[model samples]
Target: MDAKLAQIREDREELEHLLSLAQRARVKDMLSINLRKLDTEYIVTKEKLDQAQVAVTLGQASVTNTPVGRQLDANPVIKAYDTTIKTYSWDQSDKFVKVFLTGLGDLSQVSPDQIVQQFTQHSVSIRINQVGDRNLLFNIHHTGQPIDPKQSYVKVKSDMISIYLAKIERGRQWPHLRASDEVTQKPIAPPKIDETADPSAGLMSMMKQMYEEGDDEMKQTIAKAWSEGQSKNSPF
Candidate 1:
């Protein structure tokens, strides 16, 4: 992803260089291309960063040792947190839009209202501006701050219903749009098995099926390997 992002930046820079020539077409290209790249992340990144921060918090609170918990001793600042959140967001948007488009049951379920709520209710700052003609048509701004997860304001209460509808409509028409870079990352699920739970479920499931269905010779081979192993726990 970093490579991809760098390549895009390089391409964008080339376009910007052309703009120095004062060519109308190159200037238009520079504006159009750069806006698309900007638009892709402007709104969604902050939302995703906030969501990821909550996840890290939840993981920290969990009884089990997790990546975040293990790294807590590192005393990471917000800067260290950002790249992970960005990666999380990129993967999420890719998977979500891919799957969503594959089986688009109803755009209504996409919930633009909920998205709007993120902004209006929680003081998230998302701005949108339409820029350019046919060559460079796209939203100019969609950047925002993270909403306070604890807030309960209703600034977009009346507007949300229609706003949500607009989101769905836009989503259907332009799955890869550089429009409202909305965060579609599912919050990490609560742990099903924690610090004290049966840690062998993962290895047990695999080994159990292998043994029960194995021929005698294969079972003997597995037993030989097992005798040298038999781990104290499973990591799943």
Candidate 2:
């Protein structure tokens, strides 16, 4: 997964550079060609990356649920570390809450410090200990007084592999926290594109639309393709 992500990053960087050069040279034709190719590649790559991430997260969850996994999580050494770190979270009402987050994709990529930085607004501290390859034990600490767990909530950002403390109804499971509404409602499949209508023209139109409306990453991909085109001396 890491290798694939690295390669994708390299590809994206090259495309971005090409797009920059195309714009600078004012080569409208080359720019248009690169935009279409980049848009197509970006859509495919993004889908692959998303699927890979989901696989990693699901694999982690599976491993973490095993008997040995449970034992590792419950280890006294881990408990001691959690106590030593003094990490915590508080709700909007300023009530203390305990948060356990797991099933994260690319756990090795995210550091405990990064987690703390992400929750600076809540003034929450965090301690993350890797129980094994697939599980991370989080100890969250809040400066405020303890409150009812019922009034507290867990906000899971599936895309970011982040878990934030929230104020909502209780009864939601921990470690296997549910995804946010936005994530759940997001489309699982890409939009359909016509393939039979003058393939090149149809693709160009679709790519143009996607480029204009796509997110930052998609735009970066279009840019990268232009860069790649310039480097290879290819129109596409």
Per-residue lDDT tens digits of candidate 2, residues 1-236? 44543543454344334433332222323333443344445445555765666666555655777876566456423211121222332223222234434334545454444332223222233334442332333422221222344333334344233334543333443321211111323343333456444434554565566567656665666657756556798655
lDDT of 1 by residue, 124-235 (tens): 2222111111111112222221222333222222212111112212223433322223334442221122323232442244345545654565355446555534452344
Residue 216 lDDT in model 2? 64
- Candidate 1 lDDT at 38 equals 34
lDDT of 2: 0.40
Q: Candidate 2 — which residues are off by over 4 angstroms?
A: 1-26, 63-236
> Whose lDDT is greatest here?
2
